[model samples]
Target: MEKKPFFQGLTKKTIALALAVILWAFTNFELDVERDVRIPLHLSGLPEDLIIVNNAPENVDLSLRGARNLLSSFAFSNKSIPVDLQKTERGVLKIDLKRAASQIVPRGIDIVAARPSKLSLNIDMLVTKRFKVKPVLGEPDSGYEISKKLKIVPQFVKVKGPASQLGKLESIETAKIKLEGEKAEFTAPVQLQLPSQYMEVLEGDHVNVTVYIKEIILSKEFRDVDIVPRNFGELEYTTTPELKATLVFNGPYKTINDLTSNDVKVFIDGAEMGESRVKRLRVKVQYPNSDLLKLTKTSPTSVRVRVKPPPPEESPET
Candidate 1:
């Protein structure tokens, strides 16, 4: 073997080499540092649905650890790493380090800051209301039937946002709640998908809507019979919802449609019918003008008329 001193010197050189390599690695590597960030004020980029009343971690502390050269040049004041409020809403927006990063940041540095150092975003006032929702349809495949009726859970909901945006928002709707004429039920979120520039919707993610479907039936018939005045004396001419009596009919659906309401009529006979009394009764049908499904049945198929006696000869001359 070679002399011991020679090996010892070689061993020392080897150790030095390893330490130099390790130091180089540390110089190349970066450590996370906490940075304090501050935003001047709310900007115009925020969404209408969200009111960024406060900034999260108002004063953000980001941890950055990187090459000494890079760290030496890094300064929190150099650039504006804004707290993007355009997409934020009235609710709390947690700090997102992924975006807090800037071009100056190197790969080695890490982000380590207070969970929420500063902020008291005061979201503006928002008001929501109930609105009518209409459904639209697209061409559907053959043979399937869709339910025409739509059921809105809670029927309505409230939407709150900036007054300006709220005014333009005539409605909050979904992506066409369509069943494609498949004759089934449909449920989805009431996604108020606004343009990118628009504010984020802080309301619940989805709305509850229900639709029922049933096969169409074509076997019913209907008819209209003349309406007769009822208790006319009891009603003053000015009274609203004038009361009327009419003959109610029930029979073959086809036959009912074949007859007209005018064809059925109620008339009074002059056979010395007593006052406050009526006798002539008949059924007359006439042309129809409405689509009230069917007049399945009528109440008081008949009526008893009472006539008030002539006022006793006006009280003797004053």
Candidate 2:
């Protein structure tokens, strides 16, 4: 049998198909398409002791012109523009985005424009400082008081932040531990309160706080405490119905048990009388242990005071 020519088996349809494929490739490769790509801006080569203090753009819109096929391949892929700050000083520094983009982009792709042509970076030295942790507490229930100081585990924490901002910080506070209506010993874990966004707790962020609450002893009721005159050396002053008051106070059990009527002084100020014949005055309580004792109630908050002039002076003239 005679060998058929090499082109004898080639079909017209196959030739047309090959030509179409070649034409498609030529068009896609030679023609250019415009596309907008969002690329991330990566900061690198920064020392461990330095941080960016200002808000900088993390991503930039890059307008690129390239072949359609090439552009489509980078649709979902992110291109990074690296910013080197290894040799930079601590201050505001400007980076040229155009120059950075040119170095990273492939040869076929042209960077038409960047939305933000320049990036402004504010750098600061990071500093680690110690701060005392203060526990925040709320008011306890009535007749109850915090008997002991709030105890916190790891009373202090190390914080890192911009040196300028951290210099003024002396102490850090914990999240509020509510003691409202709390009457017993309580313990809880609380988070540290950071002063600013630039500040961070380098050590443990949480602390354990213990609170001690104690109930006050039963209040003592003293009947008929004598009311003394105040600032009445020359003027004789008298209160109607023999001024007396019932006093109720609360304190430690031993303190309240030892308290006597003589330990409390109830009086009305003479200066408050003015010239009125019948003047209403507020009753004030004075005690040696006023700081430790809490006055709960007074029978009559105010009293009617009457001022009188001595009438026996006329006998000296005779």
Per-model CA lDDT versus the true structure: 0.47, 0.84
RMSD in Å for candidate 1, one decimal?
A: 18.6
How well does model 2 score by local distance difference test? 0.84
Per-residue lDDT of candidate 2, residues 234-301 (tens digit): 87766777677999998876678778888888998888877776788899998867777889999789
RMSD per model, one decimal: 18.6, 13.2
**Poorly placed runs, candidate 1 (over 4 Å):** 1-140, 143-147, 184-203, 214-318
Local lDDT at 92 for model 2: 89
Q: Which residue window of length 10 is worst by lDDT in model 2?
A: 309-318
lDDT of 1: 0.47
> 163-246 in candidate 1: lDDT tens per residue?
456666655565555556555555554544442233444545455666554433222333333354433444322211323444
Best of the candidates, TM-score: 2
